[model samples]
Target: MPQRLVAVSFNAPTSELAGRVTGQGATLRDIPGTLFLGGGVPVAVDGTSIAGIGVGGAPSGDLDEKYARAGLATIR
Candidate 1:
């Protein structure tokens, strides 16, 4: 889900993309393939997104996102 989110975020808005995905009768967890809720964040270098990081096993999706952001911050 994070991977898909990052990919979609590259081309569209993450909030809107999430809404569209949910509107289509699918969830971040229910989507077929590698999908995650809020742990996936794109890694950008020099204003260019080159990769992404995904964190899991957190208590909540918000925590996962926070953790992922922390990790990205370290790299920056």
Candidate 2:
């Protein structure tokens, strides 16, 4: 699927898991696509909570970053 249009959601730290998922890409009309990355788990709110991390996929590194952020945006 188109990277910008694709959104992959994984575990997210309660505080920061939402930025890289859907907020920006949902509105950015210029972006070719979005690849939101995630592990399908909820990021623990506690510091001891595991780190929810993943990378956005795209033709370019910049686009990848954007998509990665899109996925994170999906986190609750």
Candidate 3:
């Protein structure tokens, strides 16, 4: 499948989202982006990311990782 990150804007709290997902005990890495916007795993924080949340516009390195999980948790 294609990678995608679910983010609002370039400054979206992506690190925050990734960290959240990881907080639940999941591991995510900041890799290149598939599309020009943003993208990652099915459950990513910034889906339009051109290079994953943390890799693209993540405020902090780890913060972006945390946000992804948190965002997904809200869905469930």
Candidate 4:
């Protein structure tokens, strides 16, 4: 599911699209760590999204997002 988020995020390169893909009854709700709310960030290069990094298992969703951002920074 995370991979799917990455793929959609890479293709559309927008947070709206990512969230839309995981909307209610959108087929990704059942997967664990497949949160569409936050914690998933698209990795772009030269204005093109190439990949994504997602962080899970954090105590809070905000922490998950923060860690994901940290991970993205490491590769940037």
Candidate 5:
């Protein structure tokens, strides 16, 4: 799950749980592709993505995303 989260965070403009699912719905689960699940977010600088972060084991996707964002804040 953490691997998928990281994949989606780095590949998509936003996380799938954030409502921006990448590719086709069926294809979303494909490995080696954008996982598009959730609990992930991109690390951006001046509006461009430089890296990505993901969180797992949170109670919910929202919480995971929040945690990821918080992690990003430290480096920003």
Candidate 6:
């Protein structure tokens, strides 16, 4: 199966954690034209990243991550 990319918005919060997440995500695949934000998380199954969830427009990156993780919980 092909991997999917979902980009809802680009207004993710700017913070130290965000920078770390972005850096880590960027190095994971080392792909060009990719975005790594604080609220974006990988959905891994059996140690493989099958999908991702991205949330934005929240007051903080932590809150955005909370919502994203909540969505992931339902599917898991």
User: Would you estimate the TM-scores of all the predictions?
Assistant: 0.63, 0.30, 0.30, 0.59, 0.58, 0.56
Residue 22 accuracy (lDDT) in model 6: 42
Give per-residue CA lDDT, model 2, range 1-76, as digits (tens). Answer: 2332232223332123334444544543333543333322233454333434334345555454554556657774
**lDDT (10s digit) by residue, model 5, range 6-46:** 54445542455435334566443454544444567776667
| Candidates' C-alpha lDDT | 0.60, 0.38, 0.38, 0.60, 0.59, 0.53
lDDT of 4 by residue, 25-53 (tens): 63644656654555667777887777777
**Candidates ranked by TM-score, best first?**
1, 4, 5, 6, 2, 3
Question: Any runs in candidate 6 off by more than 4 Å, and if so which?
Answer: 1-36
Worst 10 residues of 1 by lDDT: 7-16
Off by over 4 Å in 2: 1-49
Model 2's TM-score against the true structure: 0.30
What lDDT, from 0 to 1, does candidate 1 have?
0.60
Among all windows of 10 consecutive residues in model 3, the one with the lowest summed lDDT is 34-43
For residue 73, give model 2's deviation from the true position in Å.
0.5
True lDDT of residue 76, candidate 3 = 48
Instruction: State the lDDT of candidate 3 residue by residue for 1-76, as single tens digits.
Output: 1223344333344434444444444244333442322322233334442332223356644443455545546664
Model 3 misses residue 23 by how many Å? 29
lDDT (10s digit) by residue, model 6, range 1-76: 0111422222222222234444434442355555444566567767666666777789866787778778879999
Better of 4 and 6 by lDDT: 4
- After superposing candidate 3, which stretches have Cα over 4 Å from the reference? 1-39, 44-56
